[model samples]
Target: MPTTNQYEGIKHIARITTNFEDTCEHCKEHFIDPATATNHYIKEHGYKILYIGPESDISGMEHYHWTVTILGK
Candidate 1:
């Protein structure tokens, strides 16, 4: 069986979901892909990566990052 623990090292997270889910505040257009939208996000959307991932879900690489994107976005 797999175990789930609440306490972990990557608890810090920046809630940048609204931006990924919705359009840019100024232009008003949808994000192509929230998971790999860093380029689009930073360039077209003018978003800064204030936080460098290591988000709460320490389950795995894709799982951790994607969970935030799907649920949050």
Candidate 2:
């Protein structure tokens, strides 16, 4: 889960402690803190959903930056 930054700027904050492999499958990077990592994900990969903009996903839209809420919704 996000664990941090649940709604900071558009994020749905969730915390994660297990399933490191799964997280890797989704995003191939790690951060010491939620603020840095989430911010990086948003800036590096995120895209405005429809110009009107609501949800944001990973960098590649379908690959690098996945938008799945598998846990801790």
Candidate 3:
């Protein structure tokens, strides 16, 4: 068992894009898709996806992006 404080400083946000250049703010890794980026945080970093933000347009890039909030112990 772990206390709430154990998870402090372990929450992070990952930005995933549909243009095959996804980025994870915690690990600083790039992925090709949202699934890969999410899985990387879960599997490799032992983090759980807490929230998936709504898709947002990337201005003139013509592609959309979203944020994935994750937390770990």
Scored by Cα lDDT, where does model 1 land? 0.44
Q: Total clashes, candidate 3? A: 0
**Quick one: ranking by TM-score, best first?**
3, 1, 2
- For residues 1-73, could you state the per-residue lDDT of candidate 2 as single tens digits? 6587544465433333221322322467765453454445446555222112123446555633323222221
TM-scores of the candidates in the order shown: 0.34, 0.29, 0.47
For model 3, residues 43-67, the per-residue Cα lDDT tens digits are 8877765555665676686776655
lDDT of 1 by residue, 1-73 (tens): 9886433343333244422364444465556555544445566544545443334445555443332332111
Output the better candidate (2/3) by TM-score.
3
**Which portions of model 2 miss their true places by more than 4 Å?**
1-27, 47-73
**Model 1, which residues run further than 4 Å from truth?**
1-15, 18-20, 52-73
lDDT, candidate 3, residue 11? 46
The true-versus-predicted C-alpha distance at residue 24 of model 3, in Å, is: 4.4
Cα lDDT for residue 50, model 3?
53
Cα lDDT for residue 38, candidate 3: 69
Residue 30 accuracy (lDDT) in model 1: 57
- Residue 36, candidate 3: Cα error in Å is 0.8
Residue 12, model 1: lDDT of 36
